[model samples]
Target: MSTSIEELLRFEEERPPDGEAERQGWLRPVLRILAGAVAIVAVALVALRTVGLQVSIPVLAAGALAVLGVRRVTAALSPPPPPAGGGRIGGGEEEGLYNWGARDALNAAVKRWETPLDWSASRPERFASTVLPRLAELADERLRQRHGTTRESDPARARELLGERLTAFLDNPPRRPPSPRDLAVIVAELEKI
Candidate 1:
């Protein structure tokens, strides 16, 4: 059997009956506060019995006040939360709700580019398998768009147009990470192609 779109989109929460919900709205907080008060009072009474009542009561009160003071001071010292949708440092501006995957991918790419030595050392297979294929594809796409042929279709002409550095890198990517200047030159040559 099939379900209607309306059924799928409908709110699925199992809400309590109106009367029960209203009863619980006030009841839960009241019960919680009452329980906490009972616990505090029990502790206070134990202190009073252990020491003399006057000394114990004042000491308990002072302890409670100190806790409150420390909490307030800590709260004041702590930094406020970032405004919603505010991007983090070195990251791009936040996109609405479900863009975390895109942001994460972008951040990972940036990190990979930022540390070429580590990336090449740690993931040498990715360098040859992933990066080379992508660069080759880009070069082929440019050649096809501008000259009506790809590297495979017309290697001699494509290599001349693509230039020595880019052609060599695409044909056989180096085992060591290329310097930023070398990469930039290759990218510039690809754009020219």
Candidate 2:
């Protein structure tokens, strides 16, 4: 006897979403602040009791609010991660793409920063200062030896190498700088040599 086709197709359990990770950006911090405030208030209440001051319910509430406010302010001031699926080479695998993969990783890492390389500095400078300099220094000292014996060198090649990928980065080139991820990808590609 054999099972019907429909029965065979039945799944024992539902599958998870395919790596569609919703970056816990705003919401996660908000929740953390809330939790911290509650904890601080609980401590403050105990402290007030020890000091013999009548723990006013309103005062306790205000303390809780203060903690939340402080936390929110901190979170807002902190930086955010790079956009999702920005530098991914393959479907979802972040490894084995070699230089491409490394570039993808570098771009991803740099993006998780607050102040990035000043795009206004020009492509060459941005590359020289951020990506090229570092990779050239790392992989081999003489690869671009004429450019610079050390890591610091012109960023033009990096920018040029980026080509189309630099569209979003160099478009403004001033206020909005290229994220760390962009520089990283460029560096990774350069390093693979």
Candidate 3:
């Protein structure tokens, strides 16, 4: 019982709208407007206060906070740079292959290489291609160390090493650096490895 073209069009029009689409459509503009309003109000208040007007201290403090907030929000929206190196640090593709040139300093070198990359302010691609690999390797090593060398046998361990957050990031790389919280979480996980 297919409807006629006119009826179909009417039915389509009567259908409930997509809530997610509506929210997404308004999100960006709303944020921009809010940011603009904050900046404008802050500037205006600060300017008025500078002109010998008896502006309240609280007003000045609010303006300063607004300006700082706006700046931080804007900076957070900026893009990240590209990654370098073959994405490998100390533990290259051949983890078991590479022999430490020095004997006593091997642990030190591993420790140095294990140092987590700062994703809080690093490029997304750079984090994935460079920093992520090293962290993944660390996770892998930790897994290996814990339950013996069975990377193929241990799916759960591999997932843990990949990390829920890191897996999402790597699966769909961000256009900008990760948030400070995300970076910290990933770094902490890698350090544990």
Who wins the TM-score comparison? 1
Model 2 CA lDDT for position 75: 57
Instruction: Write down the TM-score of every candidate.
Output: 0.38, 0.26, 0.29
Q: Provide the lowest-lDDT 10-residue window in model 3.
A: 97-106
User: Model 2 clash pairs?
Assistant: 103-185, 107-181, 110-180, 111-181, 120-173, 124-155, 124-156, 128-155, 133-151
Summarize candidate 1's per-residue lDDT along 62-180 as a digit string, tens digits: 66656655665565556445557754444554433433433344455567768654445467776676666877899999999999989899899988888877888888788865766
Question: What's the CA error at residue 42 for candidate 2, in Å?
Answer: 0.8
- By lDDT: ranked, best first: 1, 3, 2
Pairs in clash, predicted candidate 1:
none
**lDDT of candidate 3 over 1-193, digit per residue (tens):** 8779887667434556599877878897668766766676677777887897777656665776677677766565443322355344566536664433423344554556665543445456666677666655766676688757434567666666666765566445567766778778877765665
lDDT of 1 at 137: 94
Leading candidate by lDDT = 1
- Output the lDDT of residue 37, model 1: 52
Candidates 1 and 3, the one with greater lDDT: 1
The lowest-lDDT stretch of 10 consecutive residues in candidate 2 is 167-176
Cα RMSD to the true fold for all candidates: 22.8, 18.5, 26.1
